[model samples]
Target: MSEPAAEAAAPAADNKKKKWLMIGLIGGGVLLIVLSVVLAVVLSHGKSKKGQSKAHDTEQQAEEGDAEGGGEEHADAEEHGKKEEGHEKPKAEHGSAEPEHTTETHKPAEGGKPGDEAALKAEADQLKQDIAKLQHEMDQQTEMLTLSDEAAKLKSEINALKEKKASLEGDKQKLAEGVKQIRSGEKKCAISGNPDKRLDELRACLGMSQHGESKPGEHKPAGDSHEVHWSYNGENGPEFWAKLKPEWKVCAEGRTQSPINLVGKFGSGVPALSYEYKSSALTVVNNGHTIQANVAEGGGVVLDGKRYKLLQFHFHTPSEEQINGRANDMVAHLVHKSEDGKLLVIGVLLNRGKDNPVLKPVFDNMPGKASEEKAVPNAGFDANRLLPASRNYFHYDGSLTTPPCSEGVKWFVLKNVGNISPKQYDAYTQLYPYNARPVQAVNGRAIVEN
Candidate 1:
């Protein structure tokens, strides 16, 4: 054997052994660092006594580092001697030295690398992040729902405000129209000429009340003319005339009424009617109930030797008195009054025939409005012209036919019918189509013929 070479090989073998031991000590330190990290993770979990598996894993790592030896150290130690090889190999097996190959298998024990428990930790952290994100999204959705409810409420309020604004505008327009009407009415009333003595401007303007109604404290003429307002048909018809005024109760309660059926049975001794009629100015007026013509004081008639002066004459289409239970086309009532305040009416029945010139002016100037009196200055309406040729008549004691029917009045309805044009009949019917009282019962009154 060569002594120098042998000495040099011995130092080389010693250097190799020292190098392997240094690597093993460094690996043990790294394994200890890994154990600390694993234990810290277990403690941080705060699990119960179930953390014993990590301690078992630590003992397994220690045994593996002892059994799976490193390279080059075992080959040099075997060549030296059989006895020395056994002792040195036991030194290598004592877990003081480790191989680079075993270090790679233990890399899973590092903090950031993928290992057994490290993979589970990374997944748990990822789940926590995902849950936090989901919670944040749910919070956002809840906030959006709350905001939507508020928006809907605000919209409803806005709609209500618009409707109120429209209602106010409509009221404003109506008020403006009322104001305009009042101003126009005041301007027209200013010039109607209120009389210095009389306070009513409407009546002073010749009964031409444009409004058809008088104001409070305004005076209206009292009579059957303007006191009680009535018409032929409606609530104010002849049926309700008695109910209109308390003083007109005789119209409904009187035993003897006018306009009885003129069918007679025999002839009693009665004086004939003597008429003293003359031409007079024809003055006509519509008293709302009928067309009445006022005659001057000259006209009159003599019944039973008693003198009666003609006051006025009114007309009725479809004669008020029924002849044989049938009515003619029209009738002219000659109303006369005696000096002693007694009244007697002569009802002359008229049928459609030739035109009589006597009543031409009376129907021609028929007033349209009530209480408006008009005069035909040159119209000479003779009362005798309205009488039928035969003075034979049915006479009875009755009352005034209209409201306020005062009893004890004398009535003479002529038997012979007079002729009037159909045009004249239509002219009167236009103003008063029907204005007659129904035929009343003849309560045992003697109907005598002249």
Candidate 2:
């Protein structure tokens, strides 16, 4: 009875031992399969992240190259921005798919051995590290995309600037062409032949004006030619003033020009003038144009509440300004200037009649040679005495009847004519028979009378 019981117990123990060994072997095989799957998944995920990181690095380098310079990479960055939307999905898919794979690895197989908690925790921690690495790669990609966008914007601005510069250069070339056309146009218009022509056109051809500033964007070309000297007739005369020197361009362009006709319907109320003049030293000289007398200081005239210091007095035969379309024998222009650089002129029209006591000293002091100055001390000459003993006069605004016909001169012409003997007239005519500029169009200027 003891042998039978011992044998049955031993057999039963053996069966229990073999069943436990089968369960342990099954659990070990399940754990090995799970570990292998996890390692494979982690390796795949690492490779994917590595590929993404490489792509991000390539994008960043391209952007950096664009920022460094050259427009080639700029174009590449733009291309990337348009297709960048597709690239983000891969990273998102990788993050979501990796987690799903992780969850799958974390789950134990049903109807099999239970998983070891410590091993599962270690694998989960490793997966988490891999996920963090993937996240870091995604962030890098985002930063590279931002840099690409900035580079694209900068490239756009650079392109726009390049276009603007080209436009400005084209405009400058057009302006130069226009300037060339002007230079070749009517140069004869520099004179006064065609008064109908607008002043601006003539000025443009010759670049006229004494104090003229160049217009904005204007440039002077090379090989410029200008007539330096001028004469009363022929190529350099008033008819051919278009090609004359730029300084004397006003002869044809001036609106308020000198020697303008005084035949307009004049208004009354001439400004009263007070002359503070006395006899002083005077110099008489023939300046190739007319006899001029330069007087010393202590002589001035006050008109319209402004005082003008006397500069000099000159004569023009057959008075430049016509009175009612009739010229006198000779006209004396006493030039003056105010403190503020304003100019004024007092005119005394002369008719060949009798000897002028006031002018006798000037004739006596006149030199035979041109530019021969003769000083007459205590000449006993006064500007007040030269005017006819009449307060009435004709007045107008005009310019000098000579080269550089600058306007803005205030002229006071005595209505009552003065006298000059035929002998004195002949004496002046011997030097200059036609020392007078022709009367010009009034051009709407007022010829006031008092």
Candidate 3:
């Protein structure tokens, strides 16, 4: 019994054991398959890593080749620069032999690295701009210096011109003074061309009156030039005239002037006055000094048997002949000249009581304009009636009573003076009112009473 049961059970047990063995084997095979697949993936990854490392080596080789090629190109460029430099030297040598070099060593050149070339060109432009500014500044300074020099030169010229102008002004002032002196002398000559006046049978060609100052008849002196003219004013005035001019002795040396007094009583022993009328035409001249009427072409009067020419006639107020120690109203002097030019004077007194017809012609036509000539009426006039009927007189040697006081005048004053009205005295006083000279000393000269 136990054997059969044991055999069946063993088979069953063996089946069970077989079943466990199969499951274990299947799990081991799956594990083995997974391990093989993992091993195969690792092997494939190792091969891929080897291939990438080779590719990296190839890329490094290519970079090395490019570097070598760039170095060779740089060498070729350097070699070409040396060759060009050598050629330039030979060319420069040839060019220099001909006195010129087309290529220069230090010449400005182009074509370099762009950045470097541009930077150099900018530096050169900056230098050129700076040089131009410096040049402009220098030119301005030179122009300023030139202008300063020109201004200095102009100032010197202006100073010289001012000096010349001042010299010319001084010369002009001297010329004007000289001309003024010449004009003054011309005015004086125009006043000296008139004749003197007297009454009687005598006359003087050149006549002057006796004053305290200048000499009479100075112009009549012989050998005197025309410029030796007599002056009644200035240094040639009456009192000091002889000191200025030597020929004016009549003023300093002469003693007497006309208008004397007849003091003595009338007597029978009086000498008769001789008179002769012998002139034809007469010329009346109205000078600023006095009125004078001159007889033309030798008219004369005979006194003391001597024929004296009637030269001129003039007037004076208040008769020069003092009757009873007193002068009459007016008197006329008839100046006469002898054949030798000696002078004589006959004085006639006029009264104012009645209008005397004898003096009418002379008063009617008196020359009014200065330096003008007039014709006196040649009507009949009796020179004898001018004397007093008693014929009493006083004789003295005197001078003419004017600016140039001339001596050697023979004066005959009547003792008796006729009466003249106040109207007749006024008529003569209206013209030359103060013509009478003051009485002078007789100076021991004889005074005869007729």
Model 3 scores worst on lDDT over the 10 consecutive residues at 92-101
How does candidate 2 fare on TM-score? Answer: 0.49
Predicted candidate 1 versus true structure: per-residue lDDT over 1-450, tens digit per residue: 599999989999999999998887788757854654564454433322233222212211222233455542232111111122123322323333333211111122234333446668889999999999999999999999999988876775564354344434433453455446557774233333535633344233333332334221122212222356544555556678689889877777888988888775855977677889988887686655678887765479987788998878887767889978999888888888877788899898889999978888887899765555577778887877777677888888998877667788889988898888889888888877877777888888888886
The 10-residue segment of model 1 with minimum total lDDT is 76-85
Using Cα atoms with residue i matched to residue i, what is each candidate's TM-score against the true structure? Answer: 0.51, 0.49, 0.43
**Tens digit of per-residue lDDT, candidate 2, span 78-180:** 1111123234422211000112122211222333223345567789999999999999999999999999988976875564454345434433454465567
Which pairs clash in the backbone of model 1? Answer: none
Alpha-carbon RMSD of each model: 27.8, 29.0, 40.9
Off by over 4 Å in 1: 1-226
**Which residue runs does candidate 2 get wrong by more than 4 Å?**
1-228
Question: lDDT per prediction?
Answer: 0.66, 0.65, 0.50
